[model samples]
Target: MIGAPMETKGLNANRESKPNRSRKEIIEKKKAMDALLKAASAEKDHLSAFPAFRRYQTNGLSAFLESGRGDKLASSVKHYIQNLLKANMEGLYGSEWPVEERVKRREMVAPEARYIFVREASNASASEMSTMSEQESTSASCVEKRGPMVGFVHFRFVIEEELPVLYVYELQLEPHVQGKGLGKFLMQLIELIARKNQMGAVVLTVHRSNSVAMNFYLSKMRYGLRRVMKFFAKHSVMRLKLSWRYVSVSTRNHLRRFIWFNKVVNSTLFTKGQNPAIEVLEWIIQFQQNALIIVI
Candidate 1:
């Protein structure tokens, strides 16, 4: 009958309209998400106003810290981050991470992140030094003119494993700056920031292939490895509990002396063409321990 054809046409029209309705709903949901993210970013910007700048001086070098909000300084910060990563991690991750794509991803997630820039006090210009006190830089040129940035650390405060933590995303220092105790100095500042914010722990991820980083985080800094249930094949997570009593300043000083002593011992052994035997290392450690106790 004629009515049968009409009913079929109506059903087909309804089927077509269903997809349009669903598409409209999806667009509305995306809009809502965008709005929510903007509000959250605003809130984060408000809360990060305290401790605006922390100055760190060590080994005759000075690093000025400033909190970064993703929306405000994403361009300049991303530029620094990209340059650092390309210099440091490109070889480690291989070609799997194209710089352009990686930079884009970092910029997308950077709105809530914090940054510390290590600048040589003697080399830095007035404009570069001004960034130390400013909340956020509006121009990327300031970072560019500061000569080669010596180092940087990116971190954010988050809740993981049901506890508040300060998570370090990346810590990169130039080749010349490495082995000068600047890395440890930066980590100490991060811990202080965590304690100031009442975070329960400090967490970071390391690439297994980067043995130097692994040794630095595990042996030197005393960070414990966490079994990462879901992580990239080459990466591992490390955590340091902040809930316990702070590692005393004396202990930190002892740690620094131990690190310096080991470096000297290794250099001496290598230069003298002597095998770094277990016995020799043990003896050196024991002697250093005795010396530290005496100093204490």
Candidate 2:
């Protein structure tokens, strides 16, 4: 036993069973990663996130963008992007912080940004079909860091029965871009667009796990009408159906158009060119003040 090499316990383990060392550890890590992925789904397409997602895990999609117009329950996620620029949720070292916030603190966050607008058909009534996949529609809008896309809130609307049923696509904000109330602002901005377009009410969907978004949408009491119901068995979809009255151009009659969100949230938002959905959210928040307090 004198010459007996001090068997490297872990090294021996690796030598004999490197590939099968720890199933328990592997499973737990997998679960943690899945939850992280689920939590970070909204930010899958961030500019800084691209390299990390691609090289770190080799997991990503081509739809990946620096940023794009987000879901249209009435919002401009561009606002979300701007706010995320200051999300002070974390730091880089000593302790792990939100990937984006840490990136922001050091000024390492990619200034690389893009806006995905709801590319609506110029004329939905046109004779041409937009997509071959059973009328699956798409949108195209200018991408700008400056303000060419000002005044008008670029929105995406789908016309049904000659009435525009707006499409609220999913939102993606990188971990580097969380916090700073961009989420709420995005919701309000979308409603602003809906108010302007003379389109029907706004409709959007939130995943069950996305408590942050659900809470924001639920914050609008008027928005939680039948459209914002628990109707879906597994997931929930909120539809904001508006009357022709709300879509009026005067913008003064704007608040009057809000049949549901009326007197809810910030009814003051009913003012000209204001986002009626914000009032709805306010209303919803008031109805269930404690509801929003408690995480779903």
Leading candidate by TM-score: 1
lDDT of 1 by residue, 87-188 (tens): 887786676557544553554356576666666544554435545544333236544544445787777655443234566767889888788788987787
Q: Give candidate 2 regions above 4 Å deviation.
A: 1-155, 160-162, 220-222, 225-296
Candidate 1 overall Cα lDDT vs. reference? 0.52
lDDT of 2 by residue, 144-182 (tens): 212112111222344322233333433434442335343
lDDT (C-alpha) at residue 262 in model 2:
20
Clashing pairs in 1: 70-111
User: For model 1, where is the 10-residue window of minimal lDDT?
Assistant: 245-254
Instruction: Return the TM-score for each candidate structure.
Output: 0.51, 0.29
Give the Cα error of residue 212 in candidate 1, in Å.
1.1
Off by over 4 Å in 1: 1-53, 99-104, 107-109, 123-148, 229-296
Cα deviation at 163, candidate 2, in Å, is 4.0
Q: Could you give the C-alpha RMSD of every candidate to the true structure, in order shown?
A: 19.2, 21.8
